[model samples]
Target: MTFTTRFAPSPTGPLHLGHAYSALLAYDMARAANGVFHLRIDDIDQSRARPEWEAQIFDDLSWLGLSWPSPVLRQSDRVPRYRDALKTLWDQGLLYPCSCSRADIRAAASAPQEGAPLHGPDGLVYPGTCRPASPPSGPMPDAVMRLDMARALARLTHPLCFHETGAGPDGTTGEIHPLDMLQTVGDVVLARRDMGASYHLSVVIDDADQAITHVIRGRDLFDATQIHVLLQRLLNQPTPAYHHHRLIRDDTGKRLAKRDDARAIATYRAEGCTQADIRMKIGL
Candidate 1:
């Protein structure tokens, strides 16, 4: 199959060295395979997204010697597609409205009856406070939507798995089984109360929409791939081969964040660092 990959970044902050490593790696892989490379702006969090940041992303990627086709996809402009996908799952009895806030979920998970709180890729796993016994009578306004993990898994005829060419957080590689998704990824939010769609939902839909064949990204998302694999099965979409590469970190060994402006590509450029300097810094 023709290889395809994307470097999707949220425009909430500057592109740090970590971002540079991921974008350059994906670009290099796609070019090496003579396949397509895409730039997707995951600007779904409209409250925090800034035009200047988005512009900086283009500038930084261009300065790093990367290119993608015009009319790059932005999550904000694709709400309708996400809603349609949610409706598909809702109609199939896989989704329900969730009214629990973060605090609410935490409290519920810590309750004596609930036992120790289970953590997942997205943090403390939801405690299923709003999961319904059956589909609601009609639409639920001002409520987040969550997938019924058990219900969704039951609809699958075959075991779900995805190929992994890169290491996971625990050095896991090869085919991955989504066994922990049910317990650890419990009823993950599909659509947020504020935003129409969550990362898990939007990403799955976006990959299928773009016909992405190879998902090359950081190891941080390796565990989340189980949730993605399950969503792909529920949505009847094709699963792509995954390569979760090592993350770039600071001297303290902590993974870089967008807030690390000192490590920002723009900062490095202003200090007279070239693209080669970036590659060497990130050990590419």
Candidate 2:
């Protein structure tokens, strides 16, 4: 298959230096490999997605001399598609509804007997508070949904693995360790009460649907790759090779966030910095 990849960003805020590095790196690699590079707007959280920011994404990428195919794939336009995937998992007894509030989870997870709440990609690994004792039945409720990781694992007919061109906490050639994931990644959210899908769920489906052959992101997300791999196996989609590059951090060594407006690409542009300057600033 031809090399293909994507840079998906939430339009919840301005694109910063880190965003530029990820996008430019993916676009550069795709160009070098004679592959297709896609730009996907991860605007699933409609409450925060704004038209101005969506337009700014286009403008910023263009200003950085990057381009992608027209009619960009916006997650906001694909709720039905996400729901269909959720429904399939639900029918297979691999997913269930979750009604645990943040406070409920914190209380249960912090109980003296449970030890400190274990943290995971989805944050504070779900205590399975709302998880039914058995696979849920009947129509999948239109509420928050989570993967039954243990059950999801049992459905896999073969060992799950993916090629890794990136450096993770482990070595290359990623492999899924079921027990490790069970304890750590535990029942990640698949659907949200308001957004209809969580980032993990939306990303897996989007990458597969777009036929992405390579997933390029920061090393920070290396731990989350297993979650995606498991989802790929469950959904019967191809797991792409991954390239997790180093993150762009501020002088203080903290990774750049959307709130870091000082490092915003737009701010740099206003300061009269050139694209070449950006490459140097990000150590590209």
Candidate 3:
């Protein structure tokens, strides 16, 4: 199949060095393979996503000489699509409403499970606190909806796996597998009852809709890939190959963020940093 990849950045702040590295890396791979590179704005968090930041993203990517094949896909405009996916998962009995507050989950997780560490992605492995309270019929509650991760794991007939192209111990693409969802990363939120949709659901739906074949981003998200893989299986959607590149960090060794405007792409450019300088600074 023709390779297709994307660089999806949240427009909560200006594009920083780390953002540039990820976008450039994905663009390079797409170009090298004669594939398609798509740009997507993960602006689902409407509360923080600003139009100015979104506009700046387009300017910065163009400045770096990167180009995508089509118009960018903004998550904010794709709520209906995400909602549809949630409805499907709920219909299949793969999801349940979680009303436990943030503190409640922490309290339940205070007691550890034997050799299980008592915690996972969604905080405290849920303890099934709300499981007993789940409604018997009709639509799920307005509270956050979480997929039955433990249930998802048991349904896998064989150990699930995905190939990661252009990334491995030796900087080469390799296939990794047998992702044990429950043991490592616990139940992740699929769609927060109040947030409209969770990162996991929005991302998978957008990628599939954009026909992204390879997902190239940061290593920080490598673990999260397991959750995405499981969701793909549950939804019977095609799984894309992944390439999680190393992250660009500041002298303090912390991963860059939008708040680090001192290292923002536009800032660097204003300071007379050339395209090659950026390439060197980010090790692209």
Q: After superposition, which runs of candidate 3 have C-alpha atoms over 4 Å from their true positions?
A: 112-124, 133-136, 166-180
Error of 1 at 252 (Å): 1.2
Instruction: Measure candidate 2: CA RMSD.
Output: 1.1
List, residue by residue over 1-284, the lDDT tens digit for candidate 3.
88899989998899999998999888888889989999989988988899999899999999999887666788888888888888887777768877888788777766565334455444456666665344235875566887776666667786677888655435644333434455556666888755589998998998888888999988777767777877887878889989888888889889888899999999999999888999998887
Runs in model 2 with CA error above 4 Å?
Answer: 169-173
lDDT of each: 0.89, 0.90, 0.79
Candidate 3 backbone collisions, by pair? 144-193, 166-173
Better of 2 and 3 by lDDT: 2
lDDT score for residue 279 of model 2: 93
Q: Against the true structure, whose TM-score is highest?
A: 2
Query: Judged by lDDT, which candidate is best?
Result: 2
What ranking of all candidate models by lDDT puts the best one first? 2, 1, 3
Range of the 10 consecutive residues with the lowest summed lDDT in candidate 1: 173-182
Q: Candidate 3: lDDT over CA atoms?
A: 0.79
For 24-47, candidate 1 gives per-residue lDDT tens digits of: 999999999999999999999899
